[model samples]
Target: MESSFSYKQTVPSEWVDYNGHMNDAEYNRAFSLATDAFIDHIGLDAKGREQYQYTIFTLETHTCYLKEMHEGKEFEVVARVFDYDAKRIHLFLTMYNADGEVVSTLEEMLMGMDQDEGRPAPFPDLVAEKVEAEYKVNAGEDTPKQVGRTIGIRRK
Candidate 1:
């Protein structure tokens, strides 16, 4: 969560809840938008996906809220490539407040899907190269605490 983020967003009125802060669902929406931006960064925007007949699909996500975000407040997100293979990827996205503090985190598992075949598929060569670049860029950084968390109830 300490790495610098490249994507930023300002909280909107619609995202505010009766509690006078951004709602839980709105946090997910923001993260989803960031994910789309990451897809574009990897050169798999709509047009590129069409050419490759492939796209990344979110298979699972775990979110952890660490701080409050009010409407009109600016936030940032950095998507780090936690791990990946030919067909699957685990991404760690950290959300930060204007003061550069961790506000939230989302760890998502994604899969490459072949639209033409309607099944799981390997990332195309170009995309694979990009992903490896991402991995290499973040490999030296420490893994966030929220990564790979399992939900459960503690026994006393």
Candidate 2:
């Protein structure tokens, strides 16, 4: 129910590319950081993962660059659990600039995995409950219009 403000950072100079904007890969890096924080919030934190040998693996990702971001820009990511089941989570995140303009969006599919067996696994009971509760809290959220879009040009 609370706003899920998970990650924040200033765009580093090293992230800028020849065109003078943050590089494509750097967006991914930012998203990854936000995702880590979200999972930890839901109880699959680093210490628990190491103790249980369980973790979430990103199965797929889609990113939409809605606006260009430059070095020195401060930004933050807000995440929502969108949907989930016992073994998988469908997640979405939006990156916003300091002035609150939308900069980018990311959709990701992640699967819980058992490191010992190297296979998919259901989330631990507590984690599953937390995820479902978070999903319910986010149920009123309008799915971002950019979600589920494929990269292609409209033919004239």
Candidate 3:
């Protein structure tokens, strides 16, 4: 029911790269943790997933790293539902540093999977409803500029 899902953590020293800031991989790691929290928001905890034999998979992801983060720095990842249907969700996750500035953002497409069949599947009715409700609350204004960017060098 809260507007969006959030996960917070401090950047461990191991996550830092030779450049002396957080590694690029750790930004994806933080967003991955945020997706776990988002799944819980839609009612698919470990018990529920086991009971329903359902799980979510990331179909694709686009990450834009806008700032640097050093070791031991605190950060928060916020997950928002850009859109969703019966089987898939377009999620936008943003990372904010301790001073509350946007440092990186990741946009991902996730699909529900039927574990037994090992294939994509629609979400359970309850989960679908919960996602729709959250989507309504999350798809408000001030959309992230990085939501749908493609990697390319703009020319001409």
Candidate 2, overall lDDT?
Answer: 0.89
Residue pairs clashing in model 3 are: none
lDDT of 2 by residue, 22-95 (tens): 99999999999899998898888988798778999999999998899999999989888888999999998889
Across 38-128, the per-residue lDDT of candidate 3 in tens digits comes to 8988889998899899999999999999999999989988777889999999988888898889899899999999999999999999999
Which candidate number has the best TM-score? 1
Report the Cα RMSD per candidate: 1.5, 1.6, 1.7
Please state the error at residue 90 of candidate 2 in Å: 0.5
* Model 3 C-alpha RMSD to native: 1.7
Better of 1 and 3 by TM-score: 1
lDDT score, residue 142, model 3? 71
Top lDDT model? 1
Model 2 steric clash pairs: none
Q: lDDT winner between 1 and 2, please give it.
A: 1
Ranking by lDDT: 1, 2, 3
lDDT of 1 by residue, 1-156 (tens): 333336899999999999999999999999999999888888799899989999989999999999999989999999899999998889899899999899999999989999999999999999999888888878877777898889999999
Clashing pairs in 1: none
Q: Residue 153 of candidate 2: its Cα lDDT?
A: 93
How good is model 1 by TM-score?
A: 0.95
